[model samples]
Structure formats: structure tokens, C-alpha cells
Target: MAPTSETLTAERILEATEEVLRRHGPAKATVVDVARALGVSHGSVYRHFRTKAALREAVTKRWLDRTSEALSGIVAEDRDPEGRLRDWLRTLFEAKRRKAGDDPELFATYTVLTDENGTAVGEHLADLTAQLTRIVRAGAEAGSFETTDPEATARAVFHATGRFHDPCHAREWERPGVEEEFTAVVDLLVRGLRGR
Candidate 1:
């Protein structure tokens, strides 16, 4: 089935926004720039997104959704709790890198460490960590992982992994061996979870 006109318009606007961000960076990618790229009036963009912050949020949400969609299938296919845990981290790092390259806000996760309204970014991190902890706990219960504190372990692992996945951090170590280094970290994390 074909997409509705509204859907196409939204996608076009997002594509334009992505291009704008790539060219001008997030701080400079204004709604006017997006509107001009789409040859639409500023009001048109506003109709879909009431504020520039709203638009940026949508872009960030869409980027996360896309990354989730890519990995959800793979995650579902595996049941080995230890392997699944490892795969989750591996997928996350890959997805993080992919999103950082495509969406500027994702890269900012490391630098800003706060919500636009000045709240600690730990809230955002906690949401994801909680979800991951559930999975890790399941693994622990099944004997695939031997964690005395699955929740804390998950949170620590997530924070450590974020150091590599965040664009600012990735940029500092941007070289051929970086991926290998990240891979080793994840490997060790998974091994630790397995009580090996």
C-alpha cells in the first residue's frame, strides 16, 4: 500500500532536516532551514511540529525507533540468556554508532548529559537501563547469567558501553581499532555475566 500524503510530507521534512543537520549541525538546523529545503512555508513545518524542540525530539525518537526495529527481530530470535545479553550490548553499540552518524541529538547524549530543560540525563539512561535489566534478570533466573545484582550490573554495563557508543567519545578514538576495542569490552561484559 502507498503512504498517505501526510506521511510522505512528514518523511520529506525529516529527510530535509537530516540533510540540514548533517550540513549545519544540530544547533544551526533551524525550522526555517527545513522549511526552505522543502520549499514549504515555515508555518507548514509548524503545523506538523509546534516547536523546533518538538521537531528535534521527533527526529531523535524516530532515530531510536529505527534502531530498535533493526534489532528487535534479532533479539527475538535468540534465547540463550548469556548470548542474548551479549547480543543486546553488541546491537546497542552498533545502533548507537549508526544513530550518532545519522542523528545529531543522539551524539549529544554524552556531551550534554541533561535534558533540554536541565534535568540529569540519568533519567533517560535509567529508562533504557530498566528495560535492559529486565532482560538480564530473566537471564540470571534461567542460569544463563550469574549476577548477584542484575539491575546494578545492567546499569553499570550500560554506562560503560555508552562511553564508547556516544559520538563525542567515539570521535576521540575514531580509528580502525576502535570497533575492536569496543567489541572486546562487550565480550568481557558478556563473559562476566556468564560467571566465566
Candidate 2:
């Protein structure tokens, strides 16, 4: 059987929204653009998402889900903390490379780093840091790390990784070895945490 009207409508709106985000970016994409793409009225789009912020949040969440799944896959298979951290960092850097042509506005909206001030935006990053900190604490307990402040270390490493993976960095813009260099930096970080 075919999908219900509501299901089909929802799918159409999401598709339209993605297209608009790609074409005009998140800040510029409006309900009208999505409505036009879906061949529906603006009211119909509103019926699915009451506000533009909600829709944008949904988009950002979807992107994060994709990222989380990628990271989780790496961690799930590697029980070694050092290996797991290496894989996780490599996956993130690789994702960035793969997303080079992706919508910049969408990317910016989905980042967890901007929530440094404990504000609403920081809420998501806080959760992510908590999770990473848990892993760091475990590693420390297992003698894989030499840190008394796993939470702080995790936060610092997270920010450092972001700097290394920055899209507009001069070295990142240089050539093909950027991915390898990113992984090397991650390896160095893990080794330093081991304190050997």
C-alpha cells in the first residue's frame, strides 16, 4: 500500500527542506522555498513544523544523528581506548572531508562547539562531552590514560581536534595528506594521555 497523506507530506517537506538548504543554505532557506519544492502551500509546511526554528533544529539533529552513528560504530568495535579514540577521531576527520561540498550553513548550525558558554547551544555539546568524558574516565581507570581530570581533558581534546580538522585551515587546504595528518595528531594526543 502507498504511504498515508501525512507520511507522504512529511517526507516531501523534509526532502524539500534539504534541497533548499543545499541550494540557498540554512539561514536563507524559508518555508516558502520548501513549500514550492513540495508543490504545497506554506501553511502545509507549517502544519508539519510549527516554526522555522523547530524545522532547523530537526535538520541539525538529523545531521548529528548521522555523525553520532559514525562515531558509535568506531567505538563499538574497538575495545581498546587508544584505538577507539583514534578511530573516532579519524572518522570525524573523514566525515569532514566527505562533507567538503556540503551546505556550510547546515554544517555551522549542527556544530556542538559553539555552546561554550553553558547556553542552550552548549546543551548538546555538554552531553557529547559527558559521553566522551565517560570513555576517558574508563580509559584512565584501565591504565590506558594518566589523567585525574578526564572531563577537562576530554573537553580540551575535543576543542583541539576541532582546530586540527578546521575546514578553512591553511594546512587543511593544502593537499591530500590532511586526513593522515589529522589521524596522526589524534594518535599523538592519545599517546600523550597515556603518559608513557
- lDDT scores of the candidates, listed in order: 0.68, 0.67
| Model 2: residues with Cα > 4 Å off, grouped in runs | 1-4, 9-12, 101-124, 166-176
TM-score of 2: 0.76
The candidate maximizing lDDT is: 1
Per-residue alpha-carbon lDDT of candidate 2 for residues 1-196, written as tens digits (9 for 90 to 100): 5533555466567766777876776557798998887766788788888987666666555555565666766655648777677666767666665655354555553443233223433554565566567678878988989999999999878888875445555336347776677767787888789996
TM-score of each: 0.72, 0.76
Error of 1 at 51 (Å): 1.3
Name the weakest run of 10 consecutive residues (lDDT summed) in model 2.
109-118
Error of 2 at 39 (Å): 2.9
